[model samples]
Target: MQQIIKFFLRNKTFLLYVFLLFIAVVFTIQSHSYHKSKFINSANYVTGGIYNSVNNLSLYFNLESQNLLLQEENARLHSLLSTPNYSTSLSFISDSIYSGISYKFTPAQVIKNSYSVKNNILLINRGKRDSIKQDFGVITPKGLLGIVDQRSNKFATVLSILNTNIKISAQLKNTNHFGSLMWDTKSPQVVQLNEISKIAPLKKGDTIVTSGRSVIFPKGIPVGTIQDFRLDSAENFYTIDVKLFNDMTNIEYVYIIENVDKTEINSLLKPSNE
Candidate 1:
């Protein structure tokens, strides 16, 4: 107590001056309209800055959730666009069963991806629990990516189009000339399209898309644009170089597409000679 009194006594003159200065400033602001307005403006500017900073921080933390929601919305939109058109040859019951072809799109995050290998595989954070299954076509908003190859209850592996074991049916966007899409382990952004008839009109920068001849993906899903083309060894077909729309190495989110009519389609396509 004695030490405190000694310190306060020593600084009392300076402290008194500081206190009087604060009071004088407040009185001056209250007495002058311009000063009061300036003080209110300064206080508002500071508080507004603080509030903006806090709001930005909150938005930054919510980005992941917002991204996921956007991905899901994109998947839904793609699913609607990819829905198939059924044929008119089926009976009423079959038509009812087939009912304007359906698709199930499950959004997944790419937890791991590989582009340097011949048989590259991508791992995703969706699996059987999410209805992701083997042979499900995977894609992004830009274009096709790959197919799901293996799965557990909570995770799945995708066989990238860059893999040697994969062959996707693709067609020219301007015509019905279709072929098999494969990768030669040469480039991450390019793949090979073979079995296209050499007589088919193709040009540089022509677009390619899925054929929908198979049950994996519906027709018109973009594959890539033709970068170049040349006749195959037998000279009967052209082997095309396609620059893929998706950059395989930079994939983050994808949609797993399940053909709802796959089982029925496969059953109808099976050979009956046995």
Candidate 2:
């Protein structure tokens, strides 16, 4: 206590001067309208900045929830768009009989993704319990991702487009020309489209999409854009390189697509001798 008193006494002259300066500044601001306005503006500016920082921090912490909500909304939108009678004014109807909806979409999160192997696979946070099944098409907002190949009670595996063993039926946009889409294991960003007829018009940057020839994916789902093309050794078909829109290595959210009429279609195509 004695040491503290001694220190305060020694610095009392300077402390007094500081206190007087603060009082003088306050008086000057209160006495002058311009000074008062400037002081108030400065105070407001500081408080506003503090509030904005707090708000931004809150938003950052809430990002995961916001993203989940967006994913669900996107799934709903995709379901509506896949319907044959979809309209802007139409409200979503879950009943297939009433809406004539042939496809259903379910949003899922990629719990694990692999793109560095010859046959890449993705694991999603949904399974048989969620109605996910083999041959269900998977996609992102930008492009196609994969198809579900296996499922358990609470999880499912997808055969990624990057896999060498998987082949998707794809066609050039605005035309009937279609080919088989496969991965060459060279680059994750590109896939190869084989068996496209040489007579079909080919151009760089031509958009490619699902052919809808199979019961897996509906027609017109985006695949990618043509990056390059060349004739095969036989000169009968063009082998085109496609630049995928989805970054396979960085996928997070996806939508699983179910074809409602798939069973009926498959049944009709079965061999009669069987």
Candidate 3:
């Protein structure tokens, strides 16, 4: 205590000057309108900067969670694609189901992913309450994910594009030749475009995308472009390999597509078979 007192006494002159300076600055701000206004402006600027920094930090921290959510959505798509009947059309003839079409997107997040297996699945965190249901189409902003296979109130499963059984209706963007898209299980980034007519004038760089013939997706939903392909045995068709637009490894937010007229089309097709 005596040492502290001695130190304070020794620095009393400088301390007094500092104290007076502080008081003078406060008084000047309070007494002068211009000074007061400047002080308030300066204060606002400092506070605003702090607020902005805090907000940005919060946003950055939330990104990890957001990414996890996206993975879940992708997982749902993978699961749905695993189902055999996802695109096993009842139409044994020309795909007339494309006649009546309506589609809507319900957003979802993927939580899990698997592409190594012949059959792949993606789990998403959406359910019936969000208008998600079985057979709904899933896609990201970039391209197709898969299809929704089933759903509960809070979660759903998807048949991811990586799944072997997943079939998407696709066509050459420049021509009317359409076919079913499936995975070869050899490369995660590539899929097979089946039933493409040998006479479709296809080349290595030909772009292929969703035909959107049905209400499942909008027309021109990008699937991929032709990489390399060969004629199947019997040589009636070319199974062109497509490079998918959406990178299967990094999928996030997805829009679940519901065909509003699916029931109507299914109902109409019943009697044609008989």
lDDT by residue for model 2 (1-274), tens? 9999999999999999999999878865553321122232211334434433554455565468557756865897789899998675456767657667789999887766689987776767677789787789999867799988766666676788987667889999978999999999999999999999989998899999999998999999989999999999999999999999786766666889999999999989888785
Per-prediction TM-score to the true structure, in the order listed: 0.66, 0.67, 0.62
Query: Across residues 1-274, which tens digit of lDDT does each residue of candidate 1 receive?
Result: 9999999999999989999999878865653321122232211234434533554455565567557756865797777767786443354454545565467788777666689977777767676778776789999867899887766566666778887777899999999999999999899999999999978999999999999998999899988999999998899999999999887866666788999989989999999887
Looking at model 3, report the run of 10 residues with the lowest lDDT sum.
34-43
Candidate 3 error regions (>4 Å): 1-101, 272-274
lDDT of 3 at 235: 97
Candidate 2, residue 131: CA error in Å? 1.7
Clashes of each: 0, 0, 28
Please say which candidate is ahead in lDDT: 1 or 2: 2
Best by lDDT, which number? 2
The positional error of residue 179 in candidate 2, measured at the CA in angstroms, is 0.5
Q: Where does model 1 exceed 4 Å of error? A: 1-101
**lDDT (Cα) of model 2:** 0.79
If ranked by TM-score, best first, what sequence of candidates would result?
2, 1, 3
Model 3 lDDT per residue over 1-274, tens place: 9999999999999999999999878865553321122232211234434433554455564587557656765786688789777863455455567643366667766655567887676767677678776778888867888987655456666778887655789999999899999887999999999998888898888888889876577678878889998999989999998998777876656788888877887788668754
RMSD after Cα superposition, model 1: 22.2
Off by over 4 Å in 2: 1-98
Model 2 TM-score, all chains together: 0.67
